[model samples]
Target: MAKYSDEFKLMIVKEYLGGPLGYSLLSRKYGIPDGSIIKKWVNAYKAFGKEGLSKKRSKKVYTVQFKLNVLNFMKQTGASYQETAIEFQMNEPSLIAKWNITFIKEGIEGLKEKTKGRPSMSGKRKPKQSKQEKVISREEQLEHENELLRLENAYLKKLKAFQDNPNAYLEKHKQRWHLNSKKKDLN
Candidate 1:
């Protein structure tokens, strides 16, 4: 469900357009938490009219190609997410931001449409491994134990150092308090 009704959004947009009050002032007047929402509504109204203020009931699915195009346009023009969304005629600018993030993290494959709802369960299950296959070699086990012991030895050495002279240890390690003290001294 939409938080603000279409009529309410239109009213706000009209108020912003007709009055001298800016986005921040109007947002405060309407008890809105963020002024940017009013700015978005006004921009949407100016670009697409009252229809832009109306909440879309159906979710619009964009093709991967379309997603790539929008991203490319943004990159080429150096436009903000909101401006890119307006150029693409997409109501949600956050969707473009999400696409940008996903593209950066996972490349183009991330923009592909994902299946909705719970995934179907496969009928086939993997065969259990034999006990011999599951068992680790004696040499590998010894190596793992040695690595663990080395970590424990290092930890104990650090603990003893800290116990012996906590102030020296903290100062040498540049601990939070030490850094803060340096900052205070500089100030």
Candidate 2:
């Protein structure tokens, strides 16, 4: 579909408001395919006056009041963007982008429009730990295991000496000993 400028739209609305031009003449004048649009604009002007035609027919912008309402809903209810959008019958993506920025800088009050084209709400997280990271993690685990084994070996040697010679075991020793003698069969 083609987009028309607001000026072009206002011209069409003006023509419609002026008099009956039938569907064919109106279609030719505006280069719009359907007569229905002209009829609708006429009806809208009749019911709503010039205010109806003033709005640019495109992606709608939320008013500041509306944005504040949405923000208040978010802060008070702690609703997710999806929930707030759904509750208010708003565009989820647009509402979410606004909600995020609002929460970031000015808290709830900042939900009002800054400039449009804020980035998407859900973006991909950074690439998870690379293969190199995984390999290093495994290496660290192995080193830890080796250290544990060294400590265990030293403990067992001291315990064995204590059991072998009780008198020597009673003398003051630099290192305290722990014996896990349940594994005696392994020795």
Candidate 3:
């Protein structure tokens, strides 16, 4: 697959340097699957500034079948990434990891080879939280308590609803109807 834009890579590198946006957040924010890449970018920026954030060297080949076969073998074997990499005679785990991440984010199509007519970015990076910052606001704290109350209310409501009209709930939802379907077939 192709690499990220220089601008996007610089943006993520800047975010990483600003504190609290660790590799995980950078990965999530930039849609990058590898934490090591973020770390590399951060280091590159420290060493060379914006110029260091340049997209790394890449060698693209028409390997759709190779990638798809790797994906299929991975799914069928449920093997660890390293195992699959070794089996496929791949030199880098990065490609396999990228495929897996793509699969998770999108679907089977993610495993397909990068064609000539694909979009560059699926999404952009999100603003990151700082490490020293508070994890939640007063509004969030209140919401957590409110959610508990709502859950309790829901349970009580369900109990009352069921007690008040069992047949009504059953007839409306029809969860119990499945068990009786076989009985009807026997007759």
- The window of 10 residues in a row where model 2 has the poorest summed lDDT is 174-183
Candidate 2 per-residue lDDT, tens place, 1-83, comes to 56655576667877766767786688887689888666655554555565544554476777667777777787799986656
Estimate TM-scores for all models: 0.63, 0.31, 0.29
Q: Write down the lDDT of every candidate, Cα atoms only.
A: 0.90, 0.67, 0.74
TM-score head-to-head 1 vs 2, winner: 1
Which runs in model 3 stand beyond 4 Å of their true positions? 56-187
lDDT of the structure predicted as candidate 2: 0.67
In model 3, residue pairs whose N, Cα or C atoms come closer than 3 Å (at least 3 residues apart or on different chains), thus clashing, are 20-131
Winner of 2 and 3 under lDDT: 3
Q: State the weakest 10-residue window (summed lDDT) of model 1.
A: 123-132
lDDT of 1 by residue, 27-145 (tens): 89988888999998988888788888887889888999999999999999999988998998877888999999999999999999999999678887777898668889899989989
lDDT of 2 at 93: 35
The regions of model 1 sitting more than 4 angstroms off are 121-187
In TM-score terms, candidate 1 sits at 0.63
